[model samples]
Every structure is written in structure tokens, then in C-alpha cells.
Target: MAEQQTDFDVLIVGAGLSGIGMAAHLTEKCPGRSYAILERRGNLGGTWDLFRYPGVRSDSDMHTLGFDFEPWRHEKSIADAPAILDYLHRIVADRDIGPNIRFGHKVISADFDMANARWDIVAETEDGERKRLSASWLYLGSGYYDYDEPYDPGFATERFEGQIVHPQFWPEDLDHAGKKVVVIGSGATAVTVVPAMAARAAKVTMLQRTPTWMFARPAKDSIANFLRRMLPEQTAYRITRWKNMKLQSLAFKRARTKPQKMGEALHKRIEKVLGENFDAEAFTPPYDPWDQRLCLVPDNDLFEAINEGRAEIVTARIEAFEKDGVLLSNGRFLPADIIVTATGLKLCVAGKIAVSVDGEPVDFAQRFYYKGCMFSNLPNLAVVFGYLNASWTLRADLNSDYVCRVLNHMARTGADMAVPVLPHGHGLEEDDIFDFSSGYIQRSKHLMPKNATRYPWRLNQEYLVDRKRMASEPITDGILEFSRARQDQGAAPEMAAAE
Candidate 1:
């Protein structure tokens, strides 16, 4: 194995929305800092590029999903994968961040050397060549889900003779025209795929063990468009973004505080769409709204498909897969030429990259999340985990800005190392970072970092609250300790401060 060494002031992993946004922030806020982005894939646009499934689109509006610095100029707020990719491409091209990207460099592990106050990283290329690099700060923009392998529900595939497909790894050549398609699962993917496949397929059916709350809204935001026409692009974008954030926060609070009313309201909206044909029980979930994310159907496309007799929803447990279709627990058989598994994702911590401090492997589940970005007792490392209730980019933008602030503070204070130190015996009540009841969240909670009940110690779900705290909170909080390393002896600490 060949080896190479390189150094940068900061290193960003995964050139997805988070990674690209962080780099753009660096250019704007920390121009003097040297940085590079390492992407395991050959191309950019992480999730947007990876999931090629039919009707893959953002459930969240693009106004908030877009970067704080960049304005979303698209007509459709709920954008498809290609539109999202185009937005990302524009950012990369306009900001000139393309040259700094190192594609096909998959990060295997990162070790923080406390003595030197830097991170030693090991990354492997596509050809199995190992390369070594060092950076003062490591930012993990890699998403929380496992990219190599998706979650499997363990279906009996041998009994089914027809074609089966997983949305995560959708085959480009598979044809569904004039075929009967049965999609399993009731989340966002299933809702999106059923309607999309129904366009060409003879019939499409969504099979779910339980129902999910659904909300129908126009894909194009008239208010946003009107604002854009009346005001300048940036002004319009800012106004719309702030408006959406407030609405999102209010809706989330209402769902938590008064789930019954919110759930009723959502059902009523769907009832209006389906009218006499509405299946009240099939549209209602046992749990409250926002327990799992509420699926958004743009322009009532899913409901429209159902009303047109092109697509239908079947709520039942799967007994097994037969030769031609799915066998329901109720002994009902659904004929299908193609079966699509829209199962949830398999979540992983820090892109499955092994991280250690002073050669000791770090168990994230045992560590507390610091300020929603960095971890307790971990130096010069930050991870971007987005919000559960709001647009993911909302949290991503805040985290990127917070990281830039930290880096700038270090330069101004001449500190070579910074870590959020949770002293022993500190009585911070531990809390769950994610309060979601979704299968993906429930399945992967064990792999997540610890969260505290207080501010600056938890991954907060409130976007507006987080936005203010991340921007205004003092970076020199006593919990985060900063220190300088001695030049004479690499092992000697010259000075340490927790100002």
C-alpha cells in the first residue's frame, strides 16, 4: 500500500449539502483558513446524487434547505433530486469550491493526537491506496445514514419470482410501464413512489402495516413567488426563509402540545382531498402527529392518484411474498409484477468512520453531545446532525456558522486545541437526542451520542431557538477548554484556558 501525507487547517468529510455549505461558509467567514473536502463517492451532492429512485424529492421546502448565503431561485419549493443537484452545482461553481474537493477518497479512520493538537487521518482510494493527512480541525459533513448498506426488513425473496427493488439502490434499467406495482412501507418514500410509478404502471398499491399522517400542499409557494417578484431576490429569500422557519417551529410546538387537534386538522385536509372515497382509518396513525415525520404530498398528487383509481393504499401485515405478489396477513393476495421496498434507512454515526483520541477509540454512545455540534471531551472535531422537525439545512447552516466562529476564535486567541470537557461528577441530566418514533430512529438510537437536558449540551429540535443560540452564544463557555501546545516538546502543554 502506497502512503502520502498532506496538511490543512481544516478537513471536511462528505461533499454533500452539509460539506459544501461548510466550505462556502469558510470562504465567506474564514478566508485565511486552508481546507479540503474528502468525498468517498466519485461525484458530489451526497444523498441527492446517491438515491436515484423514482420521484425522489425533498419533503422539506427548499427555501430553508438552501444555504443561508445562497437564495433558492427555483419555482418549486419542493424540489426533485435533479433540481436539488442543480442548486448544489450552482453553489459549487459560483463559490469555486469544486477544486478543493477530493473525490474517491473514502475516510476510514481519524485519530486525534492531543500532544500535537491535530488530527491524523487515514483515507483509502478506490484502488485501495491508503493516504495519510493531518488537519487542525475535522468536520464530519457525512450524513447519519449508512451509505454502503441500507436497512433490510428481511423479506422472503426466494418465494417471490418477480422483480423486487429497494429504493436506495434503484436499478436504472428497470421498466415498470403497464405493470402492476406494489410498494411496501408507508413513509415519505412510499408515498412518493406510489404516485410516481402510477404514472406509467397499470396499477400501483402502497402496503403498510400502520398508517402515517399526510399533509397536502402546493409544490410551488405562491407567497414566496409573490415576494420574489415584489422584492429583490435576497430580500425575498430572507423574508420567505424567516416566515417558513417560524411556521415550522409553531407547527411542531402545536403538534407536541396538542397532538389531537393537529392530527384532526391533518386528517381533515386529507378528507377534503379524498372526499367520499376517504378511508378515515387508513389515513390515521395510532401515534400522534410528528412522532414520525409527517409525509408531505405535493399538490395532493398521492390523493389524486388514489382518487383516479391509478394507485391505492392497503394497510395490512405482510404474511409472505408469493410467486406473483404479496400475501397479506388477512389471507388477501395482491397481484404485482414489481415489488418495491421503501423501507427506512440504516443510520450510522459519523459516516461509519472510526474516530479515536490519543489512540483510544471513542464510543460516541458514551459521550455527550456538546452545543449540538461537537462532542464532550473531544477536541477540534464537529459533526453536522440536522433537525428532525424542520428542514435539515436549517441545522446545517447554523452548525457551519458555529464551526467557523470556533475556528476564528482559535486563530484570534492563538489556541492550538479546543475541546468540550465535561468534568467528572458533573450532574447534567442525560436526554435522548432524537425524540422521533420513526422506525429508523428507534432502530439506531443506540449508536447515537448522549444528549443532556440543558442548552449547549443537547441536539435541540427547535430551529428558531437553535439559530439564535448558535449565533449569539459566547464561544468561550467554561465547558469548552482551549489550550496551546509547546513548540519545544511536542508532549508539553504550554498553556490551557477555559475562559
Candidate 2:
């Protein structure tokens, strides 16, 4: 069969926030260069569109979550999913981004055409037809999460008699009104589900395998709201955005640097809210705070739901699922008409795309990360990783700006490729990057990036430091090497290998 082929200057996989951001920057910085964003879903806003479970809101403030050029006009600092989706849609339309987006095209594999200095991307359409495309550059902004897989236990779906659902794959028609609902997992998804489910479900029980350090914060600040009304929207947004950004950054820094003090303060605040019903032992996380993602409750709504008897918290190991519900390790069975597995998402590094340079596969396990952007030996590609501590967009935006600078520098210098090349003996070790044993990061440790020392590998989550390093630094940093494409002409290989 003949393969259908299309050509572009750049081919972007996943039309999510990052991909859209990339498109916006590319169009603005390097015009007349063709680029196309291929999305698996029929719409934009990746996770926002994919996840429909109730109480979906940005855990981070919307001001920081939104693109810097675009101001988030929502009344609430922490806006819900629908509003976010709308914001992304508006950006897509207003920026003329839709023309560059091809919906229902899922990237199956991307292979580097060594001889041609290009990428051969293979994708499957919604209709099950396969197509091939080539691009000078391939940008993978797919985000980490796997779209199809649910992280429930081995026997989760088979053993559970009740309707089992994963929030990532939530069914719009699934009924929960007046039915007893059991939400599994203790991350952001579970925190959001419990409160939303409690409103309509007869009772919502949060079943956790382990405890998460959760804190209550208002979604809408009274002072910010008053200022928004009194001051201009843009001015108010700038002030609130910077104010929240600094405050959150400081809080996270304190939590990481002086954990005991900050943890104690957070614990005390949580205890005050829970009052006599608080189970300190059950609620306190085993690891230090921020080791795992912290759970955020907007305006203490989750606690309110629990105190109102609409929700209940259960901390126990699930031995198995019974005919009607979940059986705990202690042999106690909790009846439930519906079960929502808010288990974490599977992280797909570089959208599981195989990366290679000159017929050699780039072994990410051995390669060290340079400034948390480019990896050693992989030319012309940089992965944008966000802050583990604050809003993801804050770091992503900086990375995007840095990418533009690098690309602009390359164009001006006549360099065809740029890759991070750390000094010999400077490689990251596994232990330095992550110490936790939970979620996808733990499961995919071997595949993820790590830091060996304080510089590039250390992953300094501080915005001030990152801002100086990423934004203000020269594009031609010594660590990052730029080179022109090889002039050697050769035929294409029979089969491209995976990384």
C-alpha cells in the first residue's frame, strides 16, 4: 500500500496547552514556516476536554496557569475545567490556531530520517486509516499522562461488581445521583471527585490506599475580588497573578527547605478545620509534604461536605472487590453502587516517541538533562518540564520563551541542529531526581530524567532562579552545542529503530 505523506516545517503531536503554546510562539516568531498540530481527540485542551468528572478545576491559580500574553478573565482565581476549556478554545480561534490543528490524528510513532535530517511521523486517524508525514522539526507536547490506560489494580474491573470508572475515561452518561459512590485514590482527582460527588450522590466515600497531605484554601480571594471590581481587570490580574505566584513559590520553598515547620503549620490548619472529627494519623502523609503531590480543597468545600455527612473518608488497603463493593484489608466490606478510580495517570515520556541521532538511539536513562530542557546527544529537540512545586504553565512559559530564543539564535547563526552536551563524567543518577515510591514517576523511574548535581540535574523549582537561567541567560550557553546539518548524502534505511 502506498503511504499518504504530508510535509511541514514542524509537526507537533498533541494539541494540548503546550502544543498550542508552541504553535502560538512559532507563528509569532518564525512566520511563513509551515507547522501542523496533530491531536488524537477531535478537540483541543487535551486533559481539560478528556476529563469530565465533576469538580474539575485548576489546582493552581488561573492567572499563572494561563499564558502570559493571554489574561485569564475568570472571576475565580481557580477556575473550573469548562472555563479553562473555553479559554483554550478562545485562544485557538482568536489566534487562528485551528487551521494548524488536525483533529483525530494520533501519533503512533516518529522516526528520524537520518539521511534527510527530518522526522517521519506515522499516525492513525479516528477512522483507523494510517498516514505518514515528514517534518523538519517534531515537537511533542503530548504531556505525560497516558490517555487510554486506567491505573486500577490488577483485578479492579473484573472483580468489582459495581460500575467502575476512571476519571480520565469518565463516561458522560454514567449516573451517580442518589447512588452511593466510592472514589479511590487520594490525589487531586480524588479531592475534586469527593466534593462534587457528595452534592448528588447519596453518599460519597473516599477510599485511599495511603494518606495525602491536603489543605483548604479559598478559590476566590475576597481582597482580590474587591480589587478586581475597583481596579482594572488587566491590572488586577497582573497584581493577583504575581502576588499568588510569589506567595505559592515561597510556601513551596519553605515546605521543601524547612519542611518540619511548614508541615506543622499546614497540619495545624487542617486540624482546626476538621475539629473533633479529624484523624491526625489517618490524614497525615507518610512521606514529607510535596514528596507526593499535595491535595488542594477549594474554600474548604471538601471538609464542609464531610462535616455535613455527605462524604466520608476511609483509609485502608483494599484487599479485593466484593460482589457489591470493595473489601478492605481488615475484611470489612464497603457497599457502593459506583466506584471512581481516581488513580494517577501513566507518564509517557516524549509521548513515547523514539528519539535517535545518526542511527543511534538516545538512551535517556544514561543521558543527563541540561537545564531541564534539552537532553545530552539529542539534537534540535527540547522537552519543556514544568514546576513540580507551582503552576505548570509558569515553567512551561519560560521554557517556551527560551525555546524561541534558541530557535531564533539558530536561524541567525545558520545552525541546523542544537543539543545539550554535558561534560564527561557529569551524568545524573536515579536517586537524586526522585525519592518517592508512588504514582507513575515511581513506576517509570528508569525512563525519566534525573539530576546528578546542583546545576542542570538538580531541578531547581525556584522561579527566580529558573527565570534568570532560562529567560535571561544567553542562547549560546556553553552546555548547549549548535551545529550545521551534515552534508553527506545517503539513502533512507529500510526500517527505523525505536529509542
Candidate 3:
């Protein structure tokens, strides 16, 4: 049993949204392969399990966010945390994925031994047990944010008498009822929490150093429900997903071309709904559209909260935390019983797990990402990075499918190891992967991978573009180096056996 414990054809690193979707794909597409998903937490949901703050919800539409094979039956395009978690749980139960998941296994390192053509994975269990697992392939499905350590604003929490809270670790027992709440940051998370907390709180204020782009979209998709009644469940979902995907793609392109126009349009839309009471001066941002992600408020809920006198938006910088509340740089002090720091997430590369190829440490900062999924020079490893302009699961599905395609190609060719080699950098300069100017991205740009100026080297952020390329792109484009099994174990299973 001990010897058998370490063996698997593939090892998945997280049981989050991407991990679960990948597992389902592998089960359907590669039935012969043995795989296991190791989640560091006791619960299956990664981000959903970690963040329990009020008004926690998905900014992207659920039609595109849901798994390709599974159709989301819900009406709301923007779903709350509990509904999203329930969807994940339902997928697991329906697929019988519970048996394949090993909860509480925090992976420490994965070292690839070239001679054996296998990876030795070291993981520590929650109860302090160390286990070694061996596999031919590794998949990183853990989302980018670090659960153990959230981004700290470096504010003086000690001086403040009010309850200072970070959205990542929301205290369940904290009494926030009827208190004056001041939330810092203008990102999606802050916008979401403001309206939800404002429903009960006496007053909620959103304080941001710089205002982010905010737009209001309908919470429910009436067209989707209408199509669902007329068409089959799977058919309706696919059609709606594609429709949303294309619209999102078009919007990004137009925003890039006509930033000023797009920005003005968004501002006008918000102002029209907000009426005479709206603060157009505060809502207008300095940067152009799509420079950073836009904050989405469902059904003008945030605007309604502001107009109804339950919430207010303040654009200002924080000087320091006073005894009672935050002192602004503009010589204004906002008194609050509760101060919520919804600043942003701390970006992490591949979940911050240590990885080494042979004996040399893998420096992600110096590496080039191949096809936006695997790092150049890495063998049998794939990472799922979602699009910033659209739903994350769209990219996850395509990445998983690409992995299956590569694995099947190797099986057909009787090759056991495949590595992507960068072509001497082609004298092409390295550029940043993400084009956004968000604070979290700017803070962690040094630790992330770079993209090249060439195709398959430069990552595509467009969903439709990636869909076509990832599906039809040649797997062996003279870049990936494939090898047979090490001589000691056996010759790569005979070509005839693969058939």
C-alpha cells in the first residue's frame, strides 16, 4: 500500500473550480489515466471556502463561468457565494469526484527527475504527515490569490478603536449591525460589499485613493431564461455562453480602440440611473477604460444604495488610522464603527509552490509562458490562467482540453515526456503578461512570467482567439521536445499497444 500510494498518471494540485473541471475532462477524455486531486484545505471549494465576506459574489456571468460539460440552471447571471458553492458541490456529487480528492494535503514541492521522466511531489497533510507522490504530469488549478496571507495595506490597526477587517478573512462573530461602515478600495470586491452591508448598516462609505471604472449590468439574463424554456438545457447554455463570450470580446476590442468613448459611455449610463443625487465627479476615473478591470454592479444595486442614502462613495487617500476612524489626506476625518479593507488580493504565481527542474530552481520571473498555459522548458506541466476580460472558466476549459490533446498525442506517438523549449528568445524582448494597471498586479509584476512577441509565445487574452488557436494549433510545432520512457523501467509502451 505504501509503494502504491506514490503512483499516479497525473496529479492535480487543487480541488477548486479549475481542478474539478479538469478532473471531469480527464475522466471523460482519458479514461486510462489514473489521477488524484490534492486540496490543501479540508473543504473542496478553494476561493469560495476561504472568502465568506458579506455580498461575496462572482463578477463574471455564470453562463461562461460554469463548466463546459455542465450547464448552470440558475437564472442570475451574477451569482452569490452560496449559490456558486452549491453549484460546485453539485458537480462533485453528480460526478462522484469525492473519492478522487485528498483533502488537507498541502503540496510543498514538485521536482522533476529527468532520468526517470517523472516528478517526485512532496506534500504535508493537515495532521502533520508527510507524503511523497509520483506522477508523470502536474496540473496547477489553485487560483492566483494566497489564502494564508492576504494583501495588507500597512495601516496602523492598533491605533484605531474601530474593528478593521480584511475581506479575505471576514470575522463571522463580529457585530456589524447598524454600525457605520467605511470600506477602502474601489475594486469589484469593495463595490459588492458596500451595497450588501449598506442594506443593514446605518451607513456605508467606499473610500478609494483612485476611482476604478464602474458599470451596471442586469443581474438576471431574461434572454437566457427564455431560451432555456424553448431549447434543451445544454443547448441553451452553450448558445448563451458563446453569445456572452463574443460580446465580452467585442467590448474589450472597442474599449481598446476607443477608450475615451467607452469611458464616457459607461459614465453616462451610471449617471442616468443614479439621477440628480449621483456624484459624477467621484465616479469619473483618471485612466481610460480596460486599463484596469471595471467594477460591475448588478442591476444598479450599488447605485440604488447610493441614491437611497444608504451608501456613499468618497475618492481620497488615507493619511493614517485615527483613534476613532480614518484620517484622509484632504484634511477630512470619516468616523466609522467598522473599517473594512477591501483593497485587493495579493497575486501569486502557481500558488507559490516551489518547483524545480532537475536540480536548478524554476524562476517564474525569468521564464516565458508557452501558449499561456505551460512555462517554456517545463515538462508535463500545465497551469490554468483565466482571462481578465471574461469568465475564468472559459480559459480553464480550453486549457484542460489542450492538455488532453497533448497527452493523447504523446500516447499516439509513444512518447512519455514532453517539454516546451524557448527558441533562444529569438532576440525578442520580454513583455509583461497582464496589460492591466491594477495595484495588486503592479505590486506583484516582478514575480510573474513574461510573454514574447511571437505567436504561441505571446499570450492571447481574447477568448475567441484562444478558442480557435488552442483547438487547432499544432501540438508539436518544433518547440515541444518529446522523449520515450527511461530505458530502465521499459521502452515507451510499443506503438501498437497505444492503439
Candidate that scores best on TM-score: 1
> All candidates: CA RMSD in angstroms?
2.7, 3.6, 4.0
lDDT of 1 by residue, 261-337 (tens): 99889989999999987998899998999998999999999999999999999999999888999999999999999
TM-score of 2: 0.91
TM-scores for all predictions: 0.97, 0.91, 0.95
Candidate 3 ranges beyond 4 A from true positions: 1-4, 486-499
Question: Clashes per prediction?
Answer: 0, 1, 0
Instruction: Quote the RMSD, in angstroms, for model 2.
Output: 3.6
C-alpha RMSD of candidate 1? 2.7
> How big is the positional error of residue 122 in model 2, measured in Å on the Cα after superposition?
2.0
lDDT per residue (tens digit) for residues 148-211 in model 3: 8889878777888878889998999977789999999899999999999999999999998888
The regions of model 1 sitting more than 4 angstroms off are: 1-5, 486-499
Candidate 2 regions exceeding 4 Å error are: 1-5, 156-159, 230-232, 423-431, 435-437, 488-499
lDDT of 2: 0.77
Clashing pairs in 2: 451-457
- Model 2, 196-249: lDDT tens digits are 989999999999888888878888776678778889878877787788888887
Output the better candidate (1/3) by TM-score: 1
Query: By TM-score, how accurate is candidate 3?
Result: 0.95
Full-model lDDT for every candidate: 0.90, 0.77, 0.86
**Distance from true location, Cα of 428 in model 2, Å:** 6.2
